[model samples]
Target: MLKRFPFFLMLLVGLAVASCKDDEDKPPVTPAPDTVSFVATISGSQQVPLNASTATGAFTGTYDRTSKTLTYNVTFSGLTPTSGHIHLGGPGRTGGFKVPFNSLTSPITGSQVLDQQTADSLLAGRTYVNLHTTAFSGGEIRGNIQQGTTAPVPPVEFAALLTGGQQVPANGSRAGGALVAAYYPATRLLTYNVTFSGLTPTSGHIHLGGPGRTGGFKVPFNSLTSPITGSQVLDQQTADSLLAGRTYVNLHTAAFPGGEIRGNIRERRLGITLGASINSAQQVQPNASAATGTFTGTYDRTTSLLTYSVTYTGLTPMAGHIHLGGPGRTGGFKVPFNSLTSPITGSQVLDQQTADSLLTDRTYVNLHTTTFPGGEIRGDIKVK
Candidate 1:
């Protein structure tokens, strides 16, 4: 009986050892996912007003629920893009533009912090990305910013060039000013800076009104000094009004009690970089001049303004102009530069028709010289 008891004890010990071994061999459990992934296969056929373009693209993104930040990358082939934007819409629908990407080059990558409203719409699969090309100024490739996983839960920039002419009763103050501002949607905070010259600012306020009109004050600066820099938390109504372009910065002076210099607080739209490589080869009738040059500029859609600089080598430019034409073609002059010297820099406010032509890859830069007579060098202006 004693020997049988010993055997039983040993058997129980062996079983316990085997159980411990089994537990050690088990796999570890996986933690829950913290980020959501999204993807889109962009195609021309997906455009609201579909077209026959054969270009295709891919968009991949990740959204962090806790941080409310979206990181994305976009790649495409078969077309040169002019601009890209994220719009609020669903499949087969058209809506207003929400976020404009800072760059048009592929593969485009960027990170943006979203506000509660935008984040909700994104998670609900109610947003889409549209890429615009010269061939299709509206949109060439379209993709719905859809997500496979679900979770949770933003910056608008604006600027203004202050001038006396913008004042309600246009002043002759020979003074100028500028205002640059950015609004964070997440916290409803607006940070701004106002700089002025030739005026002693006694007071300043952001008033509610359109161009050439005036209304009640919505926001008052904490300081009346020049180069006023401050931040304020805005309510929903005030933020909406500001974003809708119904606000202006008014600086009051002793000489002008009403206002001295005023500027419309316009939302700075996404700007497109335009460039051209000017050589004798791009002329309608190609020449053999050894001169080469480069044209670079930024086009602001909101202001219809093109600020540009031209640089050249090996030739003396007599005159230069932006002509309306496609690549390898010729057309009439649309915009002439103020100076013909090398490294020419200037800004021009384009009419609607001329702006449209420029956006559609139908414009060229022609630099004429006495030697070449007609045109010493030419290059097609295009989105870079």
Candidate 2:
């Protein structure tokens, strides 16, 4: 009886121990729903034609994973937001998805309820928050709610311009040297000067244009102006266009109207043209050995004008004009003289001032032939 009693007690103890171990191995039930908090920067090229500081704000929003609900509190610093919404969809898709917040005013704040799937999508980076304004009815500020990562700061490329060099002779000067154009790509600010042969000068201006095309007014050249010097104070939009190969430079004179000496300026590269050498304005010469090309469209910046006339001719054009350059040799970007789209013929009216920087000598318009895919005939513009 005593042995049996001891065995029974030991069995009970072992069973109790085994039961507790089993319970410990099992996972606990899902925890009650809790709110997830996150802060994100919301910015976008909200306006169709985006500009600096267009999209603004740090938007704060919260998601209740348990209730599948979300709320957003947003405010802008510079511009007041006229409209706001919580946009759904990833990178490329239609804007319509969900709207939780509506009628967002300054110090924009709002809330919305989301379903389980939508909440999951938002966490997965399939959705985003966006705000709208009068300037950007589409959307100005946007942020993708997801696992955040830090971004590395970009390095700045800066340089200084040197002044005072040996003077060059009249009617003749040395060539082949580095010309520095200090440009801030983000702002479109430019400081440039050319250094070459010794020569004397009265004053100068930087022409914006290319073959047979002269750009708008001059960006005054100052002391820092090198061999040939000038400053083309430009806005961010204008500067972006200029960097897009739409502007150039030419030190002007009463003698050289179109541009005395011209060089097409683009990002990092410059094409120089002597004022005396080139064909007549508006004359397009085609090459025999090359595939045909033509002047198709014309656009003016200062005036905001645009004209499209499809004209095509075999060979390529030698000379053309959107004249904006003065005299001397400095050209920057170029406008589209001939393109795959509309070609040009006789006379064509142009836009008032649409992307006018493109019309400046800063761009390129060369005759392309089968033999010369690069270019066959070329000419820079001078104001006649």
Instruction: Indicate which candidate wins on lDDT.
Output: 1
- Over 54-74, each residue of candidate 2 has an lDDT whose tens digit, in order, gives 345666667777667777766
Q: Which consecutive 10 residues in model 1 have the weakest lDDT in total? A: 148-157
RMSD score of candidate 1 (Å): 20.4
Residue 69 lDDT in candidate 2: 71
* Top candidate (TM-score): 1
Q: 1-384, model 1: which lDDT tens digit per residue?
A: 887998999999999999999988999778746698988877665565554355778888898988989898889888888899888886556788777889888999998988887888888988888999888998988887778632111135566767676686775688877776766566676767788899888889888887768998878988877668666778887788888877889888899989998878866555878999999999888888999999998998757898999999999888899998767678888789889888899999999667755654568898998987689999899765
TM-score of each: 0.38, 0.34
Q: Candidate 1 at residue 137, lDDT?
A: 91
- Number of clashes found in candidate 2: 80
